[model samples]
Target chain A: MPQLDPTSFSPQLFWLAIAFILLYLLMSRLVLPRVGKVLGQREERIQGNLEKAVKLKAEAEEVLAAYQKSIADARAEAHSALNQAAAEIAAATAAREADFARKLAEQTAVAESRIKVSKTQALADIRTVAGDLAAAMTSKLTGVTVNGSDAGGAVEAVLKERA
Target chain B: MAAEHHSPLEQFRVEHIGGNLSLGGYDISFNNSALWMLIAVAAITVFMLVGIRKQAVVPGRWQALVEFLYDFVANMLKENVGNEGRKYFPWVFSIFMFVLFCNLFGLLPNSFTVTSHIIVTFALALMVFIIVTAIGFIRHGLHFLSFFVPKGAPAWLLPLMIPIEIISYFIRPMSLSVRLFANMVAGHVMLVVLGSFVLPLGLAGAYISGIVPVAAITAIIGLEFLIACLQAYVFTILTCIYLNDAVHMNH
Candidate 1:
């Protein structure tokens, strides 16, 4: 076989050494660092992206929590305001009703006093009429006359006895 | 129809190229073998350099291929030789790429296989042997000598076992080189002999004999392609294993 030729061995070895050393130097010096850098940068970028995503997610959750808390607070405030308005309306209505009742009682007391005075005046006029009727009838039948003041005393005696 | 009946072995011939100029009285002439070696080196360089020109974060196809090969070699060393093997990446990666590209390129028609020669394979194996032994000695001092002495043998059998161990250790390079050379030679010889039969037989008669060789060459070419990849892998892994032995010295 031509491969067994001793003369060809040296050239093959020489070339092999050159090719191999050239490849080794190229890989070690230029190619290895570039490739390693690309791979390393890629890893770092992916890691950074993932961390950013996590941070954004946490921020989003925090905002959601705050939003929900504000909603609950606003609802509570509205509820309390509603209750306070209802209580104020109830107090105003009660005070208005109490004032109307006190005014009605005072008007009722004034009407009662006027009604008593009218009743006393009506009794005195009746007593005068009765005393004149008695004096007229006695004068016509037996020629006798009586005063209103005496008649009023006699009527008051009769009203007291009846009461 | 008559045609040249070429010798199947004629394909292995080494011819001088460009009127070979020697230097310092050594016949280091430029030949077909040297030309192919340069092509292999060029191919490797382009595959690496141009493949990463973009160096995109999301890699293109060529960049992915480059990274894949890099990771493959890196992982091979990591598994076989551990972290201590990191320093030897350049040598290991270079040899792996060299042998792989040479073997693959040889499969092309009219291409010279660089690894098919015993001299080339022997030189590579010898280098690996020397480097591994040097590492062994440097790491363990005289304890590397104890590598050839078995631990569990009886006192009487120690003499026989030690010599056997020494012989085995020395045979590593021979075995490594011969295995690669013989495999390449055998596969190529088979393909050439079968290939020679195809065109002539097809034109000679109405018989289907040519089809048989065609089918066979097809199958064998596929097998040879697989062998090309396998041999390169085997060579690299073996280098890693030997390096492992030197670094860790379990036996």
Candidate 2:
């Protein structure tokens, strides 16, 4: 075979050495370093982006938590305010009712006292009218005149006997 | 071309190109093999350099391909030789790309296959052998000689084991070189021999009969392509394994 012919061997080796050395130099110096750098940079960028995403998500979560807490606080404040207003209204209603009752009691007591005095006056007036009528009737019918005291004493004795 | 008597061996010829020249008593005449090697180198350079011209964060298809090959070799070295093997990446990558492109280019019709030549393959294997051995010695001093000694063998068994180990270790270059050379030579020879039959068959019988060998050649060509890739991978991976052995003896 032509391959076994020793004459061709050295030249082949020579060219191979040159080609191989050239390739090694190119790859080691030029190609591989750049490729590695690019890959490393991409990886770093990806990692940075991931970290940023995580940070943003955490911030969002914090804001949500704060928002929920504020909502709860507002609800609690509103409830307390409503309770306080209701309590105040109840207290005012109770005070107003007590004042009205006290006033009504005072007016009721005055009216009762006035009715008692009127009742006594009406009784006195009735007694006088009865006395005069009795005196006038006796004089006209039997021609007997009676004094006020005599008639009063007679009415009292009759009133006392029937009592 | 059809009128000429065809010899399948003609393809293996390495005729002088440009002119005959000698350097230091060796007839280092430029030949097709030399041209092809330069072509392979140029192709590799362009593939890598142009691919990364953009150096994009998100790679385009060409850049992705380049990166994929880079990662493939890098991972192989890592898996085989661990972290210390990192320094050897350039050499391994160059070897892989060089062999791959040469094999692929050789598949072109009427092309001279560099790897098919025994001397070329032997040279590559020798290069690997020398590097691996040198590394072993440099790292471990004379302790590298202990590589031939079996780890757990009985003292009596070692007498037999050591020489055998030595022999097997030395056989590496031959095995590595011949494997690549034989595969390439056989494949090309078979292709040419079958191809020579095509015109005769077509002229002798119905033209349709010629399609049989043609179909076979087509299938085998496909297989050859696969073999080319596989061989390149094998060559590189074997280099890694050898490097592993040298870098860490016995374990």
Candidate 3:
């Protein structure tokens, strides 16, 4: 066995250091930074996707609310139209009944001949009262004209003849 | 007989590469140190490639192990170096793997301890030193010199403090290299010496003495294996510290 020499300076250390430094530089400059860039880019993309999802969710919610509101408006409009049709039907039926009653009363007067004047007076009063009530309701409900002169004069003439 | 008993450490020597170049009386050779270094790199490459080639969402056993190591190093860098430090994780990770591979390879039967040599450890330490120093200068320029002169010291103590700081700054590579080399060399030497005792006992016709030496060698070998890993850890952690100084230029 050769005697160990402690004082000897090993030159291999110098070359090894050089090689290591070169390798370290390669790793630091080339490899590491590229990986880091990829990771950072991935994180940014994920955040951007999350933001898009949130925006999309908000937009979907807004669309949903708008759709619900329009549906409610359509329901209300349908209900009002149905009520107006029913009211018109009732008014038409009542007008038809009034005409029928008037004709029947005229026929009764013709058949009897004794109370013809009283029956005509009573029929005129009933028609005048109905006109006045309709005009008042129209004026109150729709802010429209409700004239009383013609109805009042007829009603008063009928009452005087009866007296 | 005494001379016939040769130490196993004699295997490590500097030899000329291609047996030709002799520049300024220095033989530039690919020695045991270089051989082990190449082996370390090859081992790491094989391990990583083989372990990660078939990456599954539900990973196999080997893939799981590789992912665990990757996450361990990544998390360590994130915790110690911060988010910005994550940028340098690959380099740090490479250093760790290379050192760990070399250390583990050295522990095999009849294998050379590359890290036990001062040259290899010094090379690694010098790299950490140079990179950190360069980063400091690049980041701060002339102002980075102020790192040696710590803040909060009295102006009257500037002269004394400056030299102390400079000495300590210069000692970074020395401490880094010495810590790893000394630990590796000492641990391996102890194991070898203990193992040799078993041979001597057997030759002396003392079977009882052989038992103690054999048990001691076994225990020492186990301890040396642990030391191998520990030295690598120490080297990597020191590298991180040095890098922190560069990135922050705080010291």
Which candidate leads in lDDT?
A: 2
Q: Which digits, one per residue and each the tens of the lDDT, describe model 3 over residues B69-98? A: 666667766766677677677777877777
Task: TM-score for candidate 2, please give it.
Answer: 0.81
Query: In candidate 1, how many clashes are counted?
Result: 0
**Distance from true position, residue B143, model 2, in Å?**
2.6
Against the native complex, each candidate's DockQ, computed on alpha carbons, is: 0.53, 0.58, 0.11
Point out where model 3 deviates above 4 Å.
Answer: A1-11, A14-163, B1-5, B14-25, B203-206
Could you arrange the candidates by TM-score from highest to lowest? 2, 1, 3
TM-score of 1: 0.74
Give the DockQ ranking, best first: 2, 1, 3
Write model 1 residue lDDT over B1-251, tens digit each, in one string: 13333666676778898776676877888999889988988888888889888979999999999999989999999999999999999889999999999899889999999989999999999999999999999999998998887888899998899999999999999999998888888999999999888888988866676898999999999999999999999999999999998999876
**Clashing pairs in model 2, backbone N/Cα/C closer than 3 A:** none
| Model 3: per-residue Cα lDDT at residue B225 | 77
CAPRI level of candidate 2: medium
CAPRI-wise, candidate 3 is: incorrect
- Among residues 3 or more apart in sequence or in different chains, the pairs in candidate 1 whose N, CA or C atoms overlap within 3 Å are none
